[model samples]
Target chain A: MDLLLEIAQQVINGLVIGGIYTLMALGMTMIFGILDQTNFAHGELYMLGAYAAFFFSMVLGIPYLVSVCLAILVGVLLGLMYEWLIFRPVRGKDPLNAVIASLGASIFIWNAALLVFGGAPREIPTPFLGEKVNLLGVSLNVQRLLALAVTIGIILALYWWIGKSRLGRAMRATAQNREVAALMGIKIGRVAELVFATGGALAALGGALVGPIFLLQPSMGLLAVGKAFIVVIVGGMGSVLGAIYTGFGLGVLESLTVGFLSSAYRDVISFAILILVLWVRPQGLFGRTGERGG
Target chain B: MKTLPYRNLWKWVGTGLLLLIVPVLVRDPYYLHLINMSGLSILLAASLNLITGFLGELNLGHAAFYGVGAYASALLTMRLHLPFLLTLPVASLLAAFSGALIAYPCLRLKGPYFAIATFGYGEIVRLILHNWDTLTNGPLGLRGIPGPAGFINSKVEYYYFILTIVALSLLAIWRLLHSQLGRTFWAVRQDSVVLAEMIGINSTRVKVLAFMVAAYFAGVAGSLYAHYLRFISPDTFSFLESSTALAMVIVGGLGTFWGPVLGAILFTWLPELLRSVSEYRMIFYGLLLWGSITFLPQGISGFLESRIRKNCTTGVARDAHS
Candidate 1:
């Protein structure tokens, strides 16, 4: 009985963190899927979102809810800048060039943040801080619950739009073949803009949601981006449903490892799993073979 | 027959002499230390270029081999009391073995996936070093590592020691790059694996060989660094270090023989030049990486090579007109 309760509690915790991973992975997979480029600086967008939220709510005295929206807005602008400045220039070239450029941007932003914000970790206070709800003999905090709810809502809306909307179909087409889609009258630039903006907004939302829960540090995005990459790969790059499922699954697995084993083994275990997965299925579980460039 | 470029040979000889006299010319211990560090960085960048610049596969775990080499060499000297010469080869071989272990599983992955896997592998290696307290001493790292003394005690002598090793390694790399195996590496990078396979080339074997050789050279550099600095830590071999090495290769000119050498020296000194506003150093470094990669994709060495070619062509045209 005790073990069951413990497992349940761990699962709840895992789901919350998993939601954050899914949000970040959603953005990453979309960019890779449509633009055929990897954003090594994707984490910076998440980091910036957290900083922007902290600035708006804590420093500027804006409400937390409104700050989240504003942070997403900031993410949209940054995403557009990334497309124009980094990804656009390296388009159709060696895929690795884009990776290197984004990596440079990541390093630049991370260091700039360090100089500006200092190395000290910052926390954003929220009304949901200590509130809790009891279910199945387990207590869960309001802030985490709120994050989970927002994550689910965003995922659902994104799913519906991508599945049913015309623009989403255009995105899928572009992902299939960029040249063919462009020749068929799909505006590649507009699609790219939309994809990047969406990616940025999603990643920012993740940072904003998780800010009140965990202390916002400059290096948080680095670790977060690492986990998101694992999720994107395991879910198969460019597969939305794959990312959604794998994100939560990995979260639960990690929470269980931490709960049952030790915190130190969390990264080791996840990375080992990644290597194993790649060894068995190089294209990822949900990824189609030869669907994209190596 | 490929005729040797005699003019370039003279230029190399002149540069070699200058490098040999650097310690005497710059008597300041601080400058010599920077030069030695540059030698080690060049070694690292050159080895990494084998896999990244030549093989066209981004191995984010290059630093793992470096960390392994450093720890192995340091441990051999500290615990086993082995001589510097013996430990260097043994430790580097250990690192090479680890490279093979990773490459065997990872060679099938292409492009970004390959990079991601290597990144994961690198983190795993670092985590092991961080957690395996008994072997690695955990995050505190190993200190008081012995230097290559007895024969080479002074800092100046150590500079010569590193210079000799670096020069030999570069010569070996240059020779390998011009060999048949090196040509195979270039073919694998320039063409798809399917195409290469159709021509009866085992692309996987070629990649693994490149990875092993690269790891071996990185190990040599790491062993040198472990002895010189007299400190060993997991932090030194983090993802940032790997990226810095990659930056050296890219900023120098990928796949170019002399590019990483120039880049290593420039990067080594750039930080010292920015010591006044050290806080802004990384920001500047990041800006340089982005700007260079975006604006000057071919890198500085490639740019210079192009300029020289243009001038030569124009010189010919002017002479013909006359």
Candidate 2:
């Protein structure tokens, strides 16, 4: 009974964490879809988002909700700056150039954070801190449930925006064929910037939501980005829905591995699965066949 | 004309003598240490250039093979108490085998897919190093690794040891580039489909061979690193180390001979130069990386080559007009 209960708890925890992974992967996939460049610094943006939230709540004495909002806004602004300053000049160059540039940006941001905030982990006090609810004889943290609800709501909102809005249509059009979209009177450049900002915002939201659960630290971006890349690869680089599914699946798998197996091998199992997925379907689970490049 | 080969031999002898005379003239152990490190890094950067620059494969997890080589050599020497010289070849072979293993599954991937897959492979190696306590001793890391005996106990001796390895590896790589197999690698890089149709060459075979050769030299460097540092840990072979190696190749001018060497020297000493601005060293490093990619995408060596080519063309045009 105890084993079953532990397994159940692990699954719930994994699902909640998977929600954040889904958001991170979605951001990366969206950027890949539009720009065809893998933003190596996406993880750093996520880290910055967490820091933004931490600063707002801890330093500025804002409410948790206000902090989350501020984090998203800050993420969007930084994303815009990235597009304007670094990516704009190297727009048509080889994808490798962009990859290297993003790596530079990642190092720059991470080190800046380290210098400014120091290497110590910062805590974000949850709105529902110290509260636990029992479900099916298993004690579940209320903060985790809140994270799940927020993630689901955001995913639904994103789906509706992408499916029904004119801006979303333009973004999709640009992603599918930039030249054709431009010919059809779409401002492809503006759309790209918007997509990048949106992606950054989503990543920031993920970071802020998970800040309470995991301490906010500059180096925290490395692990999050590593796992997020796996999700992006497994879900296919350009598929939004694919990222969500694979993110959740990977989360559950990792949780189960940690629960049943050793915690040390958590990353090992995740990467093994990524390799297997790539071996079987190199295009990723939701990647369109023959969409070459990044 | 008859004495041309002899003249070339004499020139080579002069260069070798100059290299030997350099350390004695400097007489600074610190500079000698830097030279030794540069030689090892040259081997690493040059080997990495084979894949990233020549073959046009972006492998982000290169240090994993390096780590593999280090651990393999470290275990052989530490556990079996074998002679250090024998362990170098064993480590290189093991690393090559593992590189082949990784390449088999990952070669099918193209572009960023291959890059991401290799990244995963690197993480897996690090995780194993962290978790496999029975073999790696976990985070405690292996210590008391023996240094080279006799002359190598001194910094100048160690410089010779590394310089010899660097010279041998550079020669082997140069020869490989000039061989029929080297031509095939270039052909594959230009266009795999064209090479496949015209020459009936299996691009996969060429790629795997290039990857393995690169891994072999990296293993050699890794073994040297383990013995030089006299310590082995997972922290030493992080993604940051791999990225820096890749940066050296890119900033040196990919696919150009001597570019990586120049890049290795500049980048290796860059941090040392910025030692005064220690607080913002990494930030400056990041900005420099960005500036290099954004502005001088072809790298310093490439920029200089283009300038020389332009000047020569202009001079020839002027002469013709006159």
Model 2 DockQ (Cα-based)? 0.74
Native contacts recovered, each model: 0.77, 0.73
The global C-alpha lDDT for each of the candidates, from Candidate 1 onward, is 0.88, 0.84
B115-167: candidate 1 lDDT, tens digit per residue: 88999989998999999999889999999999877988988998889999998
Q: List the pairs of residues colliding in candidate 2.
A: none
Candidate 1 deviant stretches above 4 angstroms: A291-294, B1-9, B314-322
Clashing pairs in 1: none
Candidate 2 is graded, for docking, as medium
What's each prediction's TM-score? 0.96, 0.95
Please write out the lDDT profile of model 2 over residues A1-294, one tens digit for every residue. Answer: 999999899999999889988888888888887778778888888999999999999999999988999999999998898888777777878777777888888888899999999999889997676899999899989888888889989988998898789998888888778899899999978987897898889889989998998888998887888899999998888888888888988898999998999787888999998999888998888877855222
Model 2: runs farther than 4 Å from truth? A291-294, B1-14, B190-192, B195-197, B314-322
